[model samples]
Target: MRIVSGGIQHETNTFSHQPTTLADFERDSGCGPDFSGGQAVFDRYRNTGTIHGGYIDAADVLEFDLIPLICAKAQPSGVVESTAFDTILNLFLDRLSETPAVDGVLLDLHGAMVTAACDDGEAPFMEAVRERVGPDIPIIATLDLHANITQRMADACDVIIGFDTYPHVDMRARGREAGELLVRMIRGEVQPVQAYRQLPLLTMPPMQCTLREPMQSLMQNVFRMEDEPGVLTATVAMGFPFADISAAGVSCLVTTNNDAALAEKKVEELAGWLWDLRDELQPQLTPIDEMIEFAATHDGPIVYADGSDNPGGGAPCDGTVVLRALIEAKFQNAVVGILHDPETAALAHQAGVGATIEARVGGKTDDRHGTPIELPAYVRALCDGHFVHHGPMNQGVVGEFGPMALLLVGGVEVVVSSNRKQLLDREMLRVIGVTPEHRRLIVVKSAVHFRADFGECATHILDADTPGIHRPDYANYDYQNLRRPIYPLDNVTVDFGG
Candidate 1:
């Protein structure tokens, strides 16, 4: 059987000012450059730890012909440009039209994508594909755990599987599952029936981590349900709350072998269970000042999560709240990573290693993430910003931060980079000659993904309540489009019995 597979994956943040352009997709970073179309998808993703890699691996084992198409992705940013979205979609569809015959399609998508013209971006993309493939063809998709699933997406695809883990280590596994299920459907082994339920609740990134409590137990329950008779697959998407769209909240999806009743029952059961654990999922962050004091008093190698300014969630990744706090409090043996400031990084490169130079770093994107702090810093090290991830998430994938520099300002060491990226690996720090394991305090500009790499050695971990776009405090955001009566945003009653 010939199966066509490819996707445009992006997690849009509606609150971000930076618009995602086609150039952004084309630019190469640590995640790799974007492919316009065809065999390049197979060439770039094969043997990697990505969804496309999983599809290729499954194709080899399952002995099915897999036709490659356009697969492009950009760093998580603002709403995708209409031109960029249309161009990529048309490219994929045109390739599909060229294929002689297709039995099924597997899409690797991040369900939170929002375009300039569409709030539910993945739905429209899937609909256009459906228009080309007709009703008989089975389309399966693998999504991030933070997908803001909509009814349009549910109706457009046969099966939608989301990652069971938050740091999203399960990408390949989920992709393999989608491929396996598609193979089953193609062979008439299973008739997939899907059920979807969107919750009125939104979860913060810090609490949505599957490695921690509440989420860990919740995912365990999802796996248990998936093993039940008649159930083909199940997903518990915590949802990307950073996207200020109507569907920006928690959702549950269940698929069974042509068992609609069973699917619906499972979805409702999981949704109700999640609703009952709402309070636990709602995160409480410590104030930056208090957190610093706590860290100073605590043991070495503490990791302070700078979530509000997470570039992964579309923040600028140049927030200075934590860095400023660390400097002002005279904290010793501290390090702050991935401050996305090209000007400062360039200045460091010009100054060369072991040179002392006066430079202003971070807070360059906007006023929301603290002002740029001016300091006479010593440029300790510089790098080309290429390193492979050694963490559980995205392991073996090379990351690039463009030109990077390590600067020492007082007792604090800062890692400045030209490209905006979340601090998800210890390799990001080590690439700049600063070992994270040796630091007394390490500040990562990430929401939760850093936990996969940094959590193990951390003496204590705390989420800083910094002011930025991705802050866990829902009230701080001026959300105009999101459906009202959502939890924390409004105190609404929930009837789980129904």
Candidate 2:
């Protein structure tokens, strides 16, 4: 059987000031740059541990011809520009038109994507593809765990699967599952029936982590349900709360073998279970000062997660709230980083390693994060910012932070970077000669993804409440378009029976 495979992935934060453009997709980082046609996609993702990599492996094992098309992915950012969205979509469609007849289609999509013209971007793309391929062909798509799944997206595709892990180390595994499922369907072995249900709850990133309690137990239940008779797959997307779209909330999906009733029942069951655990999914963040004080009382190597200013969720990453607080509290032997500040990084690079320079660093994006603080910093180290991920998530993939520098600002060592990326791995600091294990405290500008790497060595892990666009204070955002009566934002009751 032949299958057409391609993807367009982006997790848009409508509150972010940075607009996602075509250049952002072409830039190297995250899942790498944009690739057009099968050869390019195959070349870049063949040996990688990405969704496409998983698809390629499955194709090799299943012995099916995988026709790859455009595969474009960008780091989480603001609303995608309409032009950029249309350009990538047109490329995928144009390539699809030129390809030969295929048994089925597999898509790698971020279900939370929002563009200027479309709030549910994946729906339009799926609808267009469905129109071209007609309704008979099987279409299966994979989504991020934070996908804000909608009815339109559900109706447009045959099957939808989302990541079960928060750090998202299961991309390859999910891709293989989708590929294997598609192969089975094409061979007339199973007929797929899917059910989608959206919940009124919006969860914070810290609480949504699969490594933690409620999500961990929830994912275990999903796995158990997947093994049940007739059930093909089950997914629970916690939803990207950073996006201010109407469908920006949690969702549950279930796919069964020609059993629509079973799918509906399973989805409703999962949703109800999640709703019951809503209180557990709300994280209690420690204030920056309290976290610092708490860390001081504890042992060395505490990990402070600055979840509010995480660049992974599309925040600027230049927030100085935690850093400033740490400095003010005279917190010694602390290393905070993966701070996105191009000007400061450039200054450090110019001063050269070991050279002391007076500069204002971080909080440059806006006042929401915090005001930039001026300090006399010694440039401890510098690098080109290239390192392989030594963590569970994207283990084999290489990451780039553009030019980076290790700055000793007072008692803290800060790793500043020109490019914005969450500190998901220790290699991000190690590349700049900062060892995390030896430090008294290490602050990562990330929500939960950092846990995949830094959680083990940390004596204590605290989610610090700071100020930024991606802050967990959901009530602070002026959400103009989200559906009414959502949980946390508003008190609401869910009727699972309906």
Candidate 3:
């Protein structure tokens, strides 16, 4: 059987001021081993700085004729540039058309992309692909746990699987499930049916994690439903709240063959369950001052989610909201990563390790998020940050935190680097010679993904409304063209497909 697979991934934040440009994608995400490398590198591309990966190791395991098109995505941005989307789409199609008659299609998609000219970006792309492939062939897709699923997406694809974990440790596993489901459908072993729903409420805070309270229980029930006879898979897409598109809301999806109706019913039940507990899914947000006070009193390390500047969710990752707050409150024994400063990093490196230097770090690009934080810090260590992901998301993948240094700033040891890196794992800290466990408070510039690695060790975890590009509040977005009459945007109630 002939199979064609590729990916176009982006999660747009309509609220962001930056446009999703080709250059952004090229610099932040692109590098298929096909591009010319005169380029300044995404030094921390994977975990070890290697790019050209999209299939997530499932490709090698399945071992079919595979064509990997450019799958580049930056953190949430403003609307995607039309030129960028068209060029990538054309390349992907050109590649697809060259291949022989295909048996199946798989896509690595971020379900929250929006274009400057259009909203619901995934629908138009899928419709184009559907037009190309026709109805008989099956299309399977895997989404980020933060995917904002639309009805058009559900209608177009035969089976859509989403990441079960927020830190995206289950990314490859979901790909595996999609690939296996494709084989089953192609073999006529199982027919796929889907059920979906959008809740009235929108967004469960930036750090809403599947391993915690309501989301954890929700994921457990999703598994239980899958174990039932005739249920192929079940998913709980918490939805990307930053994308002001109409599809932004919590959703439940179920796919199966033998009992399609039963699958729909099961999904509806789960959707209702999620809706009932919508308000409860949120992490208890602690104000920075209160969080510090609490941390000072705690015996073990406390994990703080700097929800404002998460690079994984399309944030600048350089906002000094928490840093400023920490400095003001005179908080100590805290490790906050990272302030993306190429200049400051260079200065620190030149200053040599153990030298004291004053550097202006963080809050350079977008000051609306937070004030600039300057501190006299001692350069502790510098390294070409390298580590293999020991987690499920990109396990064994090498990454680099280029020209990185540990800066001891006002009793808070900070991880500063030239490149923007997601602090999803503990090693991100450990690579810079800082042990997060040894600190009283560990502030991570991440959304929900950090919970995967740090949740186990944290005595208490709190998400703060720190400032950045990706705000959790949906109404704060300045939407010009997103479909109206949707949740939070227009306050419309949606019924589960009953």
Instruction: State in Å the error of residue 392, model 2.
Output: 0.7
Q: What does the lDDT read for residue 404 in candidate 2?
A: 96
Tens-place lDDT per residue, model 2, 1-498, is 789988789999999889999888878423345455667777766767678888999999999999988788888889999988898888888888888777899999989999999999899999999999998999999999999999999999999989989988899899999999999999999999999899999998999999989888888998999999999999999999989889998999999999989998988999998999988998888887788778888897999898888888988898998888888888899998988999999999998998999979898888788999899999999999988888888777767888999998778998899888899988888999988999989999999999988988998888887778888888769999999999988899877856
* Residue runs of model 2 more than 4 Å from their true location after superposition: 28-34
List candidate 1 stretches off by more than 4 Å.
28-34
lDDT of 1: 0.88
lDDT of 3 by residue, 100-209 (tens): 78888887787888887777787777777777888999998777777778889889898888888866777656766777778778889888888776666566555357
- Model 2 lDDT at residue 252: 92
The true-versus-predicted C-alpha distance at residue 295 of model 2, in Å, is 1.5
- Please state the error at residue 200 of candidate 1 in Å: 1.3
Show the lowest summed lDDT stretch of 10 residues, model 1.
28-37
Question: How accurate locally is residue 31 in candidate 2, as Cα lDDT from 0 to 100?
Answer: 32
Steric clash pairs (candidate 1): 30-399, 30-400
Mind giving the per-residue lDDT tens digits that candidate 1 earns over 183-268?
99999999999999988998899999999999899888988999999999999988999988899999988999998999888888
lDDT of each: 0.88, 0.88, 0.73
